[model samples]
Target: MIVTEIEEFSEIRVRARAYLCFLLQRYIPNYVPEPSLDNIINALKILKKELPQAEAFYILDKKGMQIIDAISNNSEYRRGKGINRSMRAYYYRAVREKRCILTDPYPSLLSHNLTVTASYPVYDDNKQLAFIICVDISLKDLLKLFHPSSIDSYFGHFTKISYSFFSLALLIVAILLLMKGVGSFFIMAFELRHINIKEIFESTILITLSLAIFDLVKTLFEEEVLGRHKKREASDIHKTMIRFLGSIVIALSIEALMLVFKFAIIDPQKIMFAVYLIGAVTLLLFGLSFYLKSISNIKEEE
Candidate 1:
C-alpha cells in the first residue's frame, strides 16, 4: 500500500509542488524576519482552511529549528516546538536551494503513514534567509488533493480492470503454447532414441515464444495493473521488446539450422531457403542491437 501511494504521489508530484509553492508564496513572504507566534498561527489557520487536506503547518528558523508549535486541525500533531529539523531533507533542501521544494514521501513519525513535506524558504529585507515555512501532508491525502485519476479513483480502477483482462488472455495463450511444446517431447513415449530432430526444434521454438509472451504479460500486469514503478533505464523501458525480439531471433536461428541440416541430407538444391532465413535472423539481430544502442544513448544523455 505504501508503495502504491508513493507511486501515485510521483504521478502528481509536479502539480502538487506547484500548488504548494503557490500557496506558500502567497503567505510566507508576508511573515518574514520574525512574525509573532499568535499572528503566524492565525495565518496558518487561514491557510489550513484553504488546504483542508494538509496535515500540519509549521515554521522553522534558517537553521531548521522549530520556531513554534505546529498549527494543525488535528490536535495530536500540534505540539512539536523546539525540534531540530536540520537533518531533514525538507529543511536542508529548501535552505540549500532557496526555493519552495517538496520532499519525497517517507514514513512519518507523527502520522505513521507515508508523508511529504513542502518547504519554502523565506528571505528577509536584505534578501538573506530568514525562516522556512513547511506544510506536511499524508501521501494519500496529498494524492486526493492533486491526482485526478488516482488508482483508487474510478478511471484508474477501469484501467486496471482492462489490463487485468488482457493479461489473463495472454497468460492463457502462453500456457497453451507451453503445454503444446512440452507435450511434443512425449510423442515418442519418452523414448530418446526415437525423438525427431525436427520435433525438438519446433518444441524449442514454441517454448521460447511462450516464454517471451509470458514475460511481456508479467511486465504489463505489473506496470499497468499493479502500478509497479520501473526505472527509466534503457533496459527497463524496452525489456519486453528486447525479450520478444530475442526470442524471435533464437527461434529463427534454430529453424535455419534445422532447415540446413534437413536440406543437406535430402535436397541440397533448396539450401537457399535456409540462407534467406538466416539472413532475416541476422537483420533482426542488427535491428535489435540498434534499438538497444539508441535507447542507451538517450538514457545517457538524460
Candidate 2:
C-alpha cells in the first residue's frame, strides 16, 4: 500500500509540471507589450477578465528586469506586490529563448505560500525579443495573494518609507561631495604666492571637464562593454572612484607648481603657470587610471 501511495505522489508531480508547461505554451508569448508599466497594467486587466483564477502578474525585460508598474506596486499593507526579485532569472530564461515558461510550485516568502506561475515573452512586430509576462493563479481573491499576514510575528515586516529615505540620503550625499571638490580646488589655488586668476580658471576647467567626461563615457560605453554578460553593473562605484582619484591627481599637480616656483626656472614667479600645467596633466592621468581600473574591476565582478 505504501508503495502505491508513493507512485501516486510522483504521478501528481508530473501532472503539475505538465499543466504548467501547457499554460505557457498556450497563452504567453503573445500576451503583453514590451515591459513598460503601462502595458503591463493593461495586460493585467486583460488577464483578470480572461483568466480570473490568476492571482497576479508581471512583465520583465529580456534581462529578467521588472519594469515598474508605476507607483502602483509597492511593499505596503495597502499597496500591491508581485513576485520576489529572486525569481528574475527564471523569467529571464523565457525571454532568452523567446518562448514561454512555466515554473513548478515555488514558495513566496513574502506571502508565505506555495504557488505556481507561468511566464510568457512578448515580441516586437519585427519578432525581436521583448519581455516576459508572469501569471499566478489560485481559485480565490487574487489581491489577497500579495498580503503577507497571519504569521507576521514569525518574521520581521518592513515599511517602504525606510527604503525611500535610504535612497534619498544617498542622493544628497552625492551632491554634497561634488560641491566639496569644487571648493577645495579654489581654496588651495588661493594659498600659493601671487596666484593669478588665470591659473585658477584653467585648473577649474581641467578638473570639471575631466570628471564630466569620465562620468558620461564610463556609464554609456564602458559599463555596457565590460558588464554585457553580467547580471548587474558597477556604474555608480566606478563614477565615485573616478572623481576621487582625479581629485587627488589634480591636488598633486598643485604641489608640482610649488616645486617649479622654488627651483625649476630662473623666473621664480613663472612657477605658478608651470603649476597649472602640471595639475592639468595629473588630472588627465588620474582620469585614465580611474577608467581603466573600473573596467577591470567590472570584469572581475562579472
Best by TM-score: 1
In model 2, where do residues sit more than 4 Å from their true spots?
1-40, 69-89, 138-302
Q: Candidate 2, residues 1-302: lDDT per residue as tens digits?
A: 22322222233444544554565445444544443556556646654566555556665665665664422122331223343453554575675565555554555433445545666667766676676666654311221222222112112123223333444454455445555557757676678776655456555645554455445444433223222212234665655566766655655555565556554556776766776778677668976777787798878988
Kindly report the root-mean-square deviation of model 1 from the true structure over all alpha carbons. Answer: 5.4
Worst 10 residues of 1 by lDDT: 28-37
- Runs of candidate 1 exceeding 4 Å displacement: 1-15, 28-39, 60-69, 73-75, 81-101, 104-106, 121-132, 143-165, 190-202, 221-229, 236-240, 250-286, 289-302
Reference-based lDDT, each prediction? 0.85, 0.51
Per-residue lDDT value at 49 in model 1: 97
The clash numbers for all candidates, in the given order, read 0, 1
What are the per-residue Cα lDDT tens digits for candidate 1 across 26-99? 86554356545566567778999999888899999888999888888899999789999999999999988878
